[model samples]
Target: MVDRNSPIPIYYQLKLHFKQQMKSGLLQPGDRLPTEMKLCRQLGISRAPVRQALTELAREGFIYRRPGQGTFVAPESAARLSQRTTIRILTYYDVLWMASLEQAVHHWNFSHPEQEVDLTVTMCPRSEFHQVLRRAVAKGEAPDMVPLDYVWITNYARAGYIVPLDTLDALWTRILREDLEPVVAHHNTVDGKLYGLPTQADVTGMWYRRDWFAKEGLTPPETWDAWLALLDHFSSPGMRQRWGHRYAGAFPIGTAAGEATLNLLLPFVWVAGGELLDEKGNLALDTPALRRALRFLQQITLERRAALPPQMASYRWWNICRLLGRGITPMTLGGTYEWPRIREESEWTDEADAVAHLGFVPVPRPSLDAPPVSSLGGTSWVILQQSPAREVCLEILKLVVLPENLAAFCGDGLQISAYRSLNRRLATTPEHPWLAKVIPLLSLARSRPLLSDYPQVSRFLQKMLEQVLWVGAPLEETVRQTAQALALLLEY
Candidate 1:
């Protein structure tokens, strides 16, 4: 809607209209907008104002035009910046986590009103996150700060999208070394340069029905065989009848093209003693251990039929939490970030109630004596190199990550803090008893190889996993082809 005779330029009015639509939720992330010709026809305007408006919009990061595809809404983080001192922070966390971060931002603004720095936190859906980020980066509209998965820190640092924190000052470096957990701190540093700061730390684990296990007089599985046996037992017709569920277990095998598929499945590769890279940085993905891991997945999804539908392979990461909360599956592999969500979704407000019902354990190993492995889960905050207010962003980040502020932020969201001191406090506190059960397992958590081309490698592995589990591709051929593709990527 535009006023034909208003003093405002037509292009400026059009831009404001689109912005209002996005802010009001009339348009959403990944939603395609009207084509330029369509808009021209609808508004009875020439192509000049339409092109001018879209060009400005693209530069400000409001909309992105794919080559063959039409313009789509960009990530909320890259929304056109108003004429104020604002620093945008983007995350893929749930609404609750955003609320917690919003509180910290508000407090910081209140304390420094004279030189107020507006910190806006936006939640971007994980399924579209990669596309959103790519568009934002291409337009030079990356958010001031973003929460990146640990595995992505290396890739982003290598690409020069993020600046090293060591360039800040001595005080920031000291805080990073002394306050953060060693594993988290180490992962944030790339080639001996610190590039990010941790917001929370998590370990991947499988959630089970505690009461159901107790009723059946069964303990959590400790080995691969026992794990499958548990799923088979529960998948039987009688067991399904008793539990009133359609499936025995589930996994996020979705094609969302991000960390979800990789994070949950990495433990299996580690448990079978497979590594993604060799001593010479060559692709080691075609090893027997990895084959074993893939075979087991094939068994569950194809042969035993103990897992969710084949369509589950294309589901989003959060779909598992929703399915689990609804009792669609008795078990699913997930991380600590989902516990609070499970509670809220299942309508279990009392922490004790959620604890009594939902149970999480480290992923099982290949043999009785072999220790289980968990992927190093959660994200870290990195400042984009394109941001103009780097110093102000750092100061604001310091306030947000303060010991007390961090404790409140992560604690409220049911996440383990990255700060060593806060983790130690939660390890002993009754308020965070669930975290206590997870503390010992952190010692066994494994991190993926930090490679500049890891993103492409991850995509290849994901497609390989899908081809076998969904399309019933031959195991050896698929593995070999994926390995070759990864080799080429690594070489580049």
Candidate 2:
């Protein structure tokens, strides 16, 4: 309700009211709000206050006005900011980040009564994080605290977008505990400096259906042949969810473009005993390993017939979720975030078991001699060069990365705990059942190559993958074409 008597402006009060409703479950994504006429009738306010409220809400991204559909609630990401000085969190959208970040912000506010950290949302796609982050820092409007994916820390570090954590040396040291192998810590660093703190993690996996497996008399796949047999068994043209695999739908599935493509492609790469990247992260795209990886997905999605829904040709990460949720497909190739939704029934039944029927494992490599691999997924926290409270903000990162709080994040949402000490804690979430299978799989977790030209590479790969997947091109020919394009991009 608008507090007409409060010193705060009525429209802003209304905006906050809507925001709180969103946060508290009073409203939901895509839910519609009252029309101007209806709002005036209910509030006993004139068109003036009602219109003002609508304008403010729309500006804050709380509501979207359709030509004839009236105003509807935007995704929570849209309305989470309003410009005050709370710890502004501009990163990928994840509930785990919210749970822990809000807690950290609360602690910061409580610990320092004199200072305030107002938070805002800058919901960005995974691939866009570094680009937007650098732009924000260059413009002096960077988020006070921004989470990044560790694979790209060096790229951002190279751009001078990250603030040093050395100012919070002791606290930083605790956050990056020695218990974690220096190799793991190395991902969140650049040039021997810890510029960011990794939070949760996921690697690539073949998310499949336990129900389907049991019904079809299949076991969890252990080799490329077993995986192929399962695909052959489940794939039929008329079944609603044929052969069941989905790719990245909301964000691009692979990062490092081809570097990230390994997450999706590595199972095949490893199975064939191929190495896709050398130690320095150059594409070994022509190797038998690379050929096997490309051929596997190409066959799964097209030739062998166990593929994403016909529509998934255009799917990104979220689209995969939506398609799976809607029962268009049964299996997915995705991150561990699916744990929260896997057991619950889809819209068909209020039960998650009926809906998602979830199971995930690192897809088997070609042979036992080769270790199965999955790419790490999820985001991390980084300091911003442009923050006014750069020093204090680094302190907040220390606070957020603490085990107790980070575990709390891992327990709730898509966030995977990043610290080594917290891995066991994260393993205990009986609530996130799919996680039981998810964590052991993390041992094979490798990150996408930390390429400097990631965005360009990602764009090119997406374009090329679409070309190969959609245009019916031969994998070998496609690789050569991709190599040529990449060579051109590198030359420039």
- Highest TM-score scorer: 1
lDDT of 2 by residue, 1-492 (tens): 864433233444565577778877778889988888887677665454456556645644557889997889887532343323666668653333444665676567657756656566667655566668677767878887776656667777887777767555756465475655344576776666777776677677776666766776766677767766665554554443443434211122333233344346545566577654676677656676677666666655567533335555544455455455545555566667644332221323212343246567786776677777776666667777777777777777777777777765665443456666667655675555545556677788775657776556656666666666555677788878887888788678
Q: Point out where model 1 deviates above 4 Å.
A: 1-84, 93-97, 120-124
Error of 1 at 449 (Å): 1.5
CA lDDT, every prediction?
0.74, 0.61
TM-score list, all predictions: 0.80, 0.73
Each candidate's clash count: 0, 32
lDDT of 1: 0.74
Model 2 misplacement above 4 A: 1-84, 93-96, 124-131, 181-183, 237-262, 279-281, 305-307, 340-356, 428-434
